[model samples]
Target: MAIRVQLTERQAAAREEYESFTRQAVAPHADAWDRAERLPEEFLEEFAARGLLGAAVPAGYGGAELDPITFGLLNEELGRGCSSVRSLVTVHGMASYAVARWGGDRQREHWLPRFATGGAIGAFALTEPGAGSDVKALRTTARRTDDGFRLTGQKRWITFGQRADVYLLFARLDGREAAFLVPRDAPGLTVRPVTGMLGTKASMLAELSLVDCLVAPEALLGRPGFGLAAVAASALELGRYSVAWGCVGLAQACLDASLDHADRRETFGVRLRDHQLVQRMIADMATGTAAARLLCQQAGWLRQDRSTESLHATWLAKYHASRTAFRSASDAVQVHGAQGCGDGHPVQRYLRDAKVMEIIEGSTELQQTTIAESAYHSRTRTTPTERVTA
Candidate 1:
C-alpha cells in the first residue's frame, strides 16, 4: 500500500524522481552489492549524474541544493533499495555539511565543489577505538608544526574510510578538540578495510591510522576548540534525522516484501494471506512501517523550519523507526520461514542490516537517555514557570 503523507508540489516531484531513479538504477543491483560486500565505484558517478550525491549541498557549489524534506525523501528511496547505499549518503552528507557549515571560505570553495561532483569522496572520522560515543575521550592529537599540523591518531568504524578521497577527522589541539580535513594520500596515513561486519557489509568501513599525518594550516575546520561541539550540534543532529528516514524506508521495504510473500505462498488449505496468523504478522509489519514513516515526516518538517524542538523530534523518530525496522525485519523472516534464512533471499540480508541500524549514529540506549534528559529538563523548567504564573 502507498503511504499518504502530504507533500508540496516540489517535494512530491523530487520524491517521485528519486523513486523512479532508484527503481531503475539501484533495485536490480542491491542484492549483488550485498553479496559482493562492496558497492561498485561506478555507482558513485551514477549518483552524481542523477544529482543525488549532494542533496543537501548548495547549488552555488554545484550540488542539488535540495530542501530538507526532499533530502529525506532521497535517503528514504535509497534505503528502500539498500541500506548500504543509504549509508553512503549519511557519511558523505555529514562530511559535506561539516565543511559547508564550519570551513572557511577558501576551504568551502575548494572541497564542496569536489564533493558535489564526486571528484572527492568524503567520510566523517570522529569515532575512535576508545571513543565511540565519547568524543572527549579521543586520543588523536594534532601538534603544531612550523607550517601547519601533524596529526597522530587511530579512528575505527569509519564508513568509506579506505576509498574516500578526504576525511573530516577530529583530534586534540593544545588540549582542545579540533576538526581537520585530511587527504587520503597524506604521508603516514593508512586506511585498512575492517572485515567481518554484522550489517552494512558493503558500506566499506575502515580503520584509519594517522601517524604524523601532515596537513596545511588551512586544513583546520572552524576555529580550534569548537569542532567537537559543532559536530554534535549540527552534523550529528542531521545524521540522526537522516537515519530515521532511512529506517522508515527499511521498515517499508520489509513490509512490502513480507506482504508479497504472504499473498502468493500457500500452505495447508489456502494462500498464506488467508491464514489468520499470517494476517496478524502482515498487519503488524504494515502498522509499524507506517508509524515509523509518520514520525520521520514529522521530524523532517521540524527540521525544515529549524525549530528548537527538532532535536527531540529527531531523537524520537530515530529511536522509534530503528526499533520498528528491526522488529519488522525479524517478523518478515518468520513469515517467510525457511525460505527467509537462505543465503540468496533478501530477507536474510535485511535481517543483518536491521541490527546495525540500532547501533550506528547512536545506539538505542543512547537515544532513550537523550530523550529522557530532554523531557526531564523541559518538565522541570515548565513546572517552576507555571507555579510562579499561578
Candidate 2:
C-alpha cells in the first residue's frame, strides 16, 4: 500500500519555487560538475542568495525558517537536480540547526548569520578511520587548557570538509565526549580532499586533521559530555530526513529519465514504452518513487513532535527510501541499456549516488539493527493490563 502527503498552499508554492530554481541553476550544470568532480564555491553563494542555504534557521538569523514539509520538498527538488547539491544543503542545514539547538547565545550570535548567508560554510566531523558506526570507538581527544581547550584528532569522510569555514567537531574530553566549534583556519588544522569518490563526487569530501587545535572555553556547545549520541541526536535525525527526501528525488529522477527515454527510443520496430518488459520497469520505478516520497513526508510530519516514535519513523523512512533509490536507479540503467552506461549519462550518476546514500548518515545494516530493536522492544513490552490479557 502507498500513502499520500497533503501539502499546504504555502508548502506547495515553496516546492514549486525550489523545483524551478533547481531546473534553472543546478540541473543544467550537474553533469559538468560531476565530470569536473567539484562544484564551484560560487554555486553555494547562489544557493544562499535564493534563501536555500538555511531552510530551518530562524528569520532573525537571516534564514528562511521554512517549515519541515517545505524543507523536505526543498531537498527533494535539489536531489532531482543532483545528489551533490542535495548533500550540501543537508550538511549546511544540519550545522545551522545544531547551533540553534545546542550552542550558547554567544555562539549563535557569532555563527548563525554567517551560516544562513553562506558567509561561512559548516562541516560536521564525527567519523574517524577507526570508528564509523561505533561512536564510542572515536579516539579524538579534547584536553582542557588554561586558556580554553586543545583538540587533537583525525576525522575522515567529512562532507564539505575542504570548503567549510568552520567545523562542528566531536571529541572526547576528560574521558567524556563533547562538541567543539573549530574554525577552518585554526592553528594546527588541515583538510585535504578525498579524490575520486564513487558517488557524490562533487561534494568535496575530505579528511580533517587537528593537532592541538585550540578554542576558547565558550566554543564548547551544550553541556559537558554532550557529544556522539547526545549532541548529535537531533542533527542525525535531520540528516536522515534530508537523505530520505533526496532518495525520493533520485527515484523520481530515474522514473522521469526512463519515461522520457522510453517514449523517444525505438526498438524492434516499436517505441521502447510499447514493450511489455519496459513498461513493467517503468511502472516499478514510478511506484517506488511515489512510495518513497510518501514515506519521506510521513517522517517529516512526525519530526515536528520530536518524540521517540518520530525517531523510529525517520529511520524507517531512510531505510526504505535508500533501498528504493538503488532499485529505481538500477532499473533506469537497464532501461537505457548502453546509453545509461556512458560517462555523461545522468542515470549513471544516479546509480552511483544511490549506492552512497545507503552508507552515509547511517549504513543500511545499522538502520536494520536499530529499527528491529525498536520494533522488538515495542512488541514484546507488556503493560499491566496487556500482561493480564496475555
Taking all chains together, each candidate's TM-score versus the true structure is 0.95, 0.95
Task: Give Cα distance to truth, residue 27, candidate 2, Å.
Answer: 0.9
Per-residue accuracy of model 1 over 1-390 as CA lDDT, tens digit each: 122369999999988988888889987888788878788878978887777777767799999877778888988888888898898888889889988888789989999998888888899899998997777798999999998999998999998886799999989999999888999998879999987788888888999999999999998888767646876468887788888888888888888888899888989978988999888888988898888888788877877777787788789889998999899889899999999999868788888999999998889999999889998887776767686895
CA RMSD for every model? Answer: 3.1, 2.5
> CA lDDT, every prediction?
0.86, 0.88
lDDT, candidate 2, 53-162, per-residue tens: 86868898998887778889999999998999999889888888889888879999999999888888888888999988788787999999899999998999899888
Error of 1 at 114 (Å): 0.7
TM-score computed on alpha carbons, candidate 1: 0.95
User: Candidate 2, residue 274: CA error in Å?
Assistant: 1.6
Q: Tell me the lDDT of model 1 at 184.
A: 94
* Residue 328 lDDT (model 1): 88
